[model samples]
Target: MSAGQSSGRYEAVIVGAGFGGIGAAIQLKRMGYENFVVLDREDDLGGTWHVNHYPGLAVDVPTTTYSYFFEPNPNWSRLFSTGTEIKQYAAHVADKYDVRRHMRFNTSVEGAQWDEDAKLWRVALAGGETITTRYLITATGFLSQPHTPDIPGIGDFAGRIIHTADWDDDYDPTGRRIAVIGTGATAVQLIPELAKTAAELTVYQRTPIWVVPKIDFRISERVKRLFRRVPLTQRLVRLITDALYEFFVYVGLHHRQLVYRRLNIAASDLAKIHRFLSVRDPELRRKLTPDYDFGCKRPTFSNDYYRVFTKPHVHLQTSGIEHIEADAIVANDGTRTPIDTLVLATGFDLWEANFPAIEVIGRNGRNLGKWWRDTRFQAYQGMTIPEFPNYLSLASPFAFLGLNFFNTMEYQMRHMDRLFGELKRRGATTFEVTEEANKRYRDRMSELGARSVWAVGNCAGSRSYYFDPTGEATLLRPMSTRAALKEASRFPLTDYQFS
Candidate 1:
């Protein structure tokens, strides 16, 4: 170990160096928090953006709006940013703000215990190091954990199996027969990209998803140069584009007529695409048809996924995989698809299920896992847990998910900065959101969510991560940015008696 590595404790400890973690660190630092440490298991930051580097893994959100409002990128080379580009942008932002000095890379946290006696948190790392802090911030996002399907005989399969989150850097899939399981956003983006290199590709599907065209293109050097030369152009573009997408989210999240029409327009456009695109029989087209209302499942955009099925080299397996036998996958229809590679685009763990693995003991010896379990894994504002005192979550329970993740993270971090400053000023050892304050916020938000397209929409047979296993649609926030701001504005810190 280097001499004087500084085992000194900080005022706060943040887990995961994703968008939320880095943004929170910056906010805290801006608020004059020099003692806090941002700990990440990965050698680098970027959260999901860092790990999932599979082929064609990119942000579907437009480049203009999919970043921090505080730190806009004028040099986005394309309409939709690729995973690598996003990572580069994140690294740039971190460097520009001098936030890397506060980060501890490759230091996985085992668990944290809230030291009630000292009014501090004792952080346990994978190594023998332990650090204590008065506060904890969890920015480990919704997509941090990969969900691998627990198929029997999966381990026995001779072929290489890779989760989208854990793509092998050295492994190449060129000219190999590959089987891709699941058809979410990840699947749609990856399948098309893999088609170029793979000799043959078979996409397994249990349920079909709704995908529209992604109007993506590379911005010319002249445009980017112009943007850099005139900063207002980027600002103006960002403002206009941000407002445009926010409307789509607004209707989808809130109960506005515009969202309904947009949903209809979405369905009509997709249904029309399938009508001309599917050269296969009517049964195949119908099987490919989605049962749920548009926007029920996370909406995807792909210009090539449907077109890839038209490829003679690529085949779409409409039937579900029954089991893995020897070196092949046997489907429910008694057909076997042989492949040398298996890729799971099976999405993430948004159920807040990873809480138990990391012990976060809060007030009165209460663990976060137990509290979440006892309370049905719900968060008050999708931020603070009752017994956790000064600790806050990034994704929380139900904050809206978006590519503009850093924007939300910075916003929440700033809010937290205000609260922490208040705590310091009052010289209070225990400062928590009153239980009444928490419940009231949730109740009102639930009412607002019910009116939106997310809850009471015409969804039928679509199964998605957006809906929990029970089919209750409560994951993403149903409120728009304007609505969220209003809701956030309602919950002033002074409403809760901090002591």
Candidate 2:
């Protein structure tokens, strides 16, 4: 159906078709509410999976822990499933839960504003259409917008330029000389693949990333059958994986100064060891080794990422790209290398173009992005804002829990159920979090954040995306996943104003 032709009110409107939006829709259905719509600008349902199909794309987190806690996929091809499998899983879940019927593909939302008189939200779409709904939920994932770096003479480059997020399917790099910029997680997965084919591969690195060995293996049919026959077995595996992930992220990363600073040191040493075994050259290994502490920026898992650098044809250029000539990139120290193709592995724009991902105006002309920037980026429990009544931002600051996004989605689903249950019980049309409650939660998070590695560790040169413009590491919440779930379910009802 054409989205622009449909203009009407809904009980609720969900502004994403990703896993978060699917989970929220499931929660709403479980609450016996069906009058809603899921909207995505893309033509497909899976958000990142649909947008990103670059070579060697797979989940960094283990597949056992990355799935929804309530719904487990018994037949995973690998321990770390490919992007295609994740997208299939998303479609399966949406179909099984019957939420696909309520989704509108190829729909772009421009902005949303609160209607004070009607106590509803007026959502503006790209094609001059308005959708009014009692509740507005923005599940636009954190990494929604692709960020193209503003390097000098980028537009004048005569070589073919490709961003990993928007990979060209027909383009072949078998015999071409290629240059890749930005060595983030995506590059870790892709560089090895490019090295196998490219005649000459150059990687321009600004900061070295900590890459650990991935213990990924194909799942046997016997194990798959066992998981299918006994769902409890899968649940137990998920529990164990979740525990290990939580421990590494919570204790190893966040509590580096307190108990077991050796854990972080050991992890760093392991990465160094991994690099030493792969790249025998002392200078190359030194250039690959990170100077900052581990977990300042998120670490990736890959066995081949380091080994790829050892190849004769592959060159690691530490002198950053100065500018792009028509067919080559010049280094800052006046070294220029010609290339036929340029690949940008630069990641998403999290703060500026993302966060809200669109313009959002609340009661009394309060803009969400402007407010967050002028003051500080804070969300009450990472879901609700003080002035945004009946609004839920799924990817807000302090919302992402653990390394696995499924953990975040699970707790947020619970939060949604509990919050909406109160609204139904009170017969309220609108609900907004109290300013006092928001402040208290923000203060508590700030206190916890002080002990994190990003705060106390050496991160000046890290250039981590975790740090916002205020120089605060406000992306991941400082608390453990268990605490986040507990708080989500048991937060005081008085924290919100129901009317």
Candidate 3:
């Protein structure tokens, strides 16, 4: 396991074991490439699902749209499936596709460097092992890294501290005082569960989130049988869900100012109505309401999130935390609240910490993270970068499509198919996006993003994770899912240079 010694070589090295990695492995196998391997830092296959087992964790999107279009699960327990079911689905797909054999769990990749003369990538692992591969596809998800607040005295806290990402399943909250920080999507799901058991619960809110009614219900056995009997029935449901998802993304978020601002307003009005109905206290509802547009940040669905605050034992603290003591959290207004357990529901550091998730030194000594920070974050069609030859970053800017990640994964799988097919047809060993093509695509994305709510709408007060440090919405592509799929297949092959 020396630094200079290579553990092995492969045709491709995928740096994740999540759904993205599983999909990539299946595509590679389908393309007659069996020498690829999938690596993950976690001990299990599911990425987010394996890392997060917090109470009340479930899919915000419907089950119909959240799964792979190719491998539909007919037995989803509910419209919004639980995290456990999603994890099981991941295992099923990996096993059914025979991709699990290619995965190496508890394997952390520290960095990767493209060897120009060798025309391959040298990936460094945490245990001092190197892996050489012709193509490097990083499927490290956007939410891989959790963001713990750098609040003073956090280290000195004597009480049990838990991050939702690193939740301890053994810990119970009964009869214990708890303080939860953050009000994001994860917090929206977790706060209600904590309110049920904790003797006293206090929520530290930095920013309010838009919460709508989650139309979740248990799927009947008859529906499951029908879905299994007729797969096309699920496809039709998927189509309808996808259409609704596209409409929301296009009208409510991407085209807020360009086509219809009223749609976004109507969405906000719906959230307000849901809030008004859920929480009877006007002041609590006011504190829970978001000040920005509906799509400024990602929204979540919950039936009891708003009602949790109305309980007498649950308190909502709007004043930001000053610092944490050993047994208490002090507010900015000099108010202190003592709690036995501290829960950090703060979300991930997307642009700052997790864009690449590992060091990538590409051709000509180009540092991917530093270059992105110096310039703007740009990737050609959100897959290939100009300087990074033989590389595909699945979580790259503009790669995400609509609300469902399956849409992004589906299109990226197609993109890989087309790109690799061209590589095989040309008998080339390496492929890098042309600089002109990358720039053209980046320009087009910027142009489209100018019309998005993140760019033009009132998002300053939102503290949206969608906006990067450069104040740009570099996460999601501003195009429809159909367009993304079409472009993935039909994009000019000349966009990349093969050698």
Candidate 4:
């Protein structure tokens, strides 16, 4: 019953104590199932929030709709909560649901193999410990692992080098010359914060991102009191926010020209803000504009990202990076710029097969990595795979909903709850997705993705992580949130084979 005590076998073992793992534990406990353990590598929960401690990290989605549907928090300080507040919310949920007692922190899964004779999963952990379980749920999210590009002579950098994901708490950048590479989501939030302190800040942008204005403000105490008094008011607000975000799905994934025209007009307004209000220089304004259509890649929301460029000490460089030296960066045009500190914001490895970051051996010694590489990534409803019995992947291919990830996690958890309930009803010990069913789902996904903007848009040069190397958009579901919720709620169990 204690943490990390491996004397007896478990009914289920959920990996990575993020929102997904905690949500799964809470759901299982609520269903009167308690023989499970949640394992996390870190000493605490909040997978991404526990790791990323950057200067100005915040969620882009509104806090009103970013929480679990069952348990809503009426005490959000801002419209978009900061990273620290989000992590605190995760902790609060874990404690409130009594899920923290079942968590084994500082325990990492090295590999997982299916034992054919025992019909159980043999999960190897760090420190040479092993645990056996009837079911394995992987909650290791897509954004947990940080991806750093291989630049020439990167190791030869003489100053402090940091990636946005692995920021150092002791290192201070005040009055220091800082160079930031890759202007992605993390960079857009942290750059403005860094610009306030750094003596001279230089940003190396590979491609322009479409950043709209962020309408963030504090929720007053009176509003919070009203939300606490009448919970339905908050619920209605969340519903409206969710509906507005789903409208973006229609504009981005489906080529709705009318909605696109309206979005273009909004984008034109943003362009005026950029050219007239933010930057006065002509060349700088041109470099800031994106050539591709909106939603080709992930759209960012920020109010000060463009305004930071107008500062006298800040510089934006769009030239290709050639290499790195001891204390400077070399551009493709042979221009050398000196820097005291380096920061790499080069996003995560979302599309690769090496994501689970561990060896997973399925039936017939089939490696999950090799199988994905050979046949491409395919999953049945983004939860179960073809050959991996008694295994479920949270937020896998076609599982991510762009509106908000918390909704996606809740949907997957609900689907898994049904699967487990069905298994209990049928008295089955194992389950695997049928190959035919997985293929049909994958074909449908490909067909829908082909018409999505990420597949056919002019975002090839944007270095977006939306698509894989084979030009397939494997990240997002090309359906509305309501449609995805309905499907997850009542999918047929005939697609799975149980024993």
- lDDT of prediction 2: 0.91
Please give, for residues 322-391, the per-residue lDDT of candidate 3 as tens digits: 9999999999989899999999999888888888899999999999999999998989988999889999
Model 2 has a clash total of 0
Q: Is 1 or 3 the stronger prediction by lDDT?
A: 3
Please give the lDDT score for candidate 1.
0.76
Error of 3 at 306 (Å): 0.7
- Model 4 TM-score is 0.96
Candidate 4, run of 10 with poorest lDDT: 252-261
Residue-by-residue lDDT tens digits, candidate 2, 1-499? 2234445888889999999999999998999877888999999999998899999999999899989988999989999999999999999999999888889999999999999999999999999989899999999998999999999999999989999989998989999999999999999999999999999999999999999999999999999999999999999998999899888998897885646489888998899889989999999999998889888988999999999988999999998878999999999989889999999999999998987899999999999999999899999999999899999999998888757899899889999989999999998878999999999999999998898898998888888889898899888888888998998899999999999
Q: Whole-model lDDT for model 4 versus the true structure? A: 0.84
TM-score of 3: 0.98
Each prediction's RMSD over C-alphas, in Å, is 2.5, 1.4, 2.2, 1.6
Task: Tell me the deviation in Å of residue 260 in model 4.
Answer: 4.0
Ranking by lDDT: 2, 3, 4, 1
Q: Model 4, stretches more than 4 Å misplaced?
A: 2-8, 256-258, 261-276
Which tens-of-lDDT digit does each residue in 1-499 have in candidate 1?
1112546587878898888888888887787777778889998988888988998989988888888877878888899989999999989988898777788888888898888778788989887889888778888877777788888778889989999999998878798989998988889898988899899898888778877777899989998988889988888988888787776666544563765767666755765575457536566566667776676677777777777777788887876778987678888888888889999988876665554336788888987877766665556666777777777777666665443564566457556766777777987756777777777766766777677666777666677666655555656655666555554545587645677
Clashing pairs in 2: none
Candidate 4 per-residue lDDT, tens place, 262-341, comes to 77567657755755567778788889888776676787888899989999999998887899999999988787989999
lDDT of 3 at 426: 91
